[model samples]
Target: MSEILLYDIPRKDPENGPWSPNTLKARLALNLKGLPFKTVWVEYPDIPSECKKIGAPPTSTEADGTPRYTLPVIYDPSTKKAIADSYAIAEYLDATYPTDRQIIPAGTEGLHAAFNKAFMDSVYFPCMFTIGPLSVSALNPPSERYFRTIRGDLLALVDSVRPEERWRKVQAAFEVVNGWYEKADNGKVLLMGDTPAWADIVVAALLVCARNLLGRESPEWKAVSEWHGGRWAKLVAALEGKVLYPGYGWTKQGGQS
Candidate 1:
């Protein structure tokens, strides 16, 4: 078994955003695939140093030399391979491990590929567009003072978008996700079938982020919202803390706390 090291920020507060989803997805995938790995929780503004030490790129670096970032950059110590990006990391695990307990389906690569792309467009992007701005705006003046100096670019990126438009886009995306989930599940418990698949993991991560961060009440996404709050809860709870590969723990605990 290969040793895996996941680089992510510790979930100190509940509203941390991207890092939570990134870590959650990686942990779930590892559990679903039955891989074992160690988690290395780094703080915001120091992640770049941690990344460099582990042979990974710094996603963000401050002028004062800090590296707060996202992505559970997976380092396979045995092979000296480091991978970043959530979907890429998941795909790598699925292909390399290839188990009967596969996270993404074996024969349905096309479907998974489409789902992955759609997720980025529909769920991930829009949700970030909405929450990122709100989160920054809501930060206390002193806290904002610290973050603004280091992450001013990110703050500016979200501030450029109109809040109304961001909300509308997020709503539209959730509706699309809900529709897709309804069609895929066909009133079943899981997204694809009785068993949870890679598609489930992808959507589950999206719903978790949306509901937790973007406000759970959406008239347009009622069904999807309900399903996510209900059915998906059971799935994640059942798989909590199960390791899927070396050094990676597939546990929901990383995000919830």
Candidate 2:
């Protein structure tokens, strides 16, 4: 099979590669499927142009109603098709590849959809203040400049909060998420019990993002590792062998496009 090109926003750390949660979702999906691919690092400013060059559709609209192009676009050279959006990418891979251990799996779409929304609300947004600033520091110079320009208000908002308050909210957010996990059968590490699925990929991406942005030794990350009775720590550990870092399953290619 011809290599599927994965468009990812590169960070300064080449060894760790991409750090954004959403892009990691797509990358993790491809890794889980054992697909052959190469990472084409697209800087923040280049995402719109690169996506347009490949005809990857805009995933959303900006506040002013202009189309917004995002990263984590996969261009399958074999099929000559470009797909955008992480969850959509998962669905596409499951449909096109049809592995026995499918990402979406049959009859779980609605459940997964509900969990996605709940996870975003309960955990993702609330934890942003804690993790958001760290993301800026992780970016390459060009992407950092572009990110500051567009996300100034958000970064400022993150800075305005007291560190104590920010951490309190983060812990609270995870507490809510912990409740959801508790509803699963006893000792279930993943959302789908022993089986990993798209939901597991999503949560794992968040944990990986946290670990990277916060630094593994940082107190924030340490606290998270111990949260919910060490639930997240175990989840990350379980996925350590599955989630491929750079130079493992895929090669990083040069050039913006």
Candidate 3:
């Protein structure tokens, strides 16, 4: 089969490659399935245009009623299909490459969906205040400008919180998620026992982004790495060393083929 094309956003740190949690989900899924793919980096400001050019549908609408396109889009040369959204891309990959280990295993769709919703609400949302500001610094100049412009209100909200309170909330959010992981049978590293799946992809993606955003040696990263007896850190290490595809890399410029 021909290589799959993954659309992702670029960060200023070329050494770290892609950094968005959403896009990383797609990257992790592709690697876990052992698929051959290459990244087509999309700049923050050029996402809509690049997506439109590739026939990827808009994932949402901006607050101003303008259609909003997002990355984590995949264009499959074999199938001549362009899929938008990370979850949808996962589903497509599973269906097309059934021989590979399934991301959303049979009889677990509802469970996975529910887990994703709760994760977004309980963990991702709360931790945004702590991690979101760090993302701004990681972007290239145009992307940084675009991020600051579109996320002014969110940035304001982030700034409104005191550092101590932000840390407390971030800790509380992860603690709730850590409790969920603890419920997994046999103290497994993955959400699903003895196997890597969609849930693990969702989590490891975030952990990696956090490490990049916080800087691996920063105090915030150190605190997160030690959380829940180092469960989160171990999870990322496992994914990086064992599961995810090692071939992932990015072009210097975004929105280029």
Candidate 4:
């Protein structure tokens, strides 16, 4: 039995904590395929150096020049390979484990890629603002600061906003996401084909992040979880036990390979 090691940022709760959506992508892909793996938590300051030691690319430029790596890096002992980045990891899994379940169903790969890109452009960033700040609170001081500095350079920090304005933006973003859900089977079914795929996983990650960052009762939570007439909530419920592959799922202490 070959095992894989997943490099991810340590957080308060693996199931509902401040986690990387990109990292969640790889974890979802692996779990979807029922692969066995273990997670190694890396501190914020260590990501770059740790990733480079495995021949991974720099995820971000560092002030101290420490290599600046990112999450979702996986090393598979069976194949003697270390893959970095979430999408790459998903693709690698698809190719290497042909007999196993796929990342995006067969034949729809091209279409799915295009669809995912469009969704990323339109919905991902907006959702980021809604959950990014919440994630920071779950991190240790150093990691939180590191995350804020890097992300803050790109957009306004969610914590800086007044409560009224914050909720308003979160509501607006939720509307946008709900609109997409409307486009996706009118919020009736999954985003892709009959079965769940990467796109669904993307939303699932968003939903999970929102839940983790915002208490379930938070207004932001209501906006996302209840928008589109409870589309997100329903979708999450439908996918709860399905997407997670066999054995040692996220519900467990360790869902590693």
Best-fitting candidate, scored by TM-score = 3
Overall local distance difference test of candidate 4: 0.71
For model 3, residues 1-257, the per-residue Cα lDDT tens digits are 99999887777776664568999899888887888888876778998888888799999998899998988899999999999999999889889998535899988988988989998998887777788888888888999999899889999998999978988987888888889899989898888887689998998988888887877889888988889999999898878875653655443233224
* TM-scores for every candidate against the unseen true structure: 0.70, 0.92, 0.93, 0.83
lDDT of each: 0.63, 0.83, 0.83, 0.71
Flag the better candidate by TM-score, 3 or 4.
3
Model 4 misplaced stretches (Cα beyond 4 Å):
13-15, 59-68, 149-180, 183-188, 245-250, 254-257
Residue 235 shift from truth in candidate 1, angstroms: 6.8
lDDT of 1 at 225: 41
Per-residue lDDT of model 2, residues 1-257, tens digit only: 99888888877875544468898888888888888887788899999999999999999998899999998899998888999999889988989888888888799989888988988887888777788788888888999999999979888888888989988998888888787778778868877787678888888888888888877888878988888889999887766666554333433443223
- Candidate 2 or 1, higher TM-score: 2
Q: Weakest 10 consecutive residues, lDDT, candidate 4?
A: 248-257
Q: In model 3, where do residues sit more than 4 Å from their true spots?
A: 250-257
Weakest ten-residue segment in model 2 by summed lDDT: 248-257
Q: Residue 115 in model 3: shift from native, Å? A: 0.6
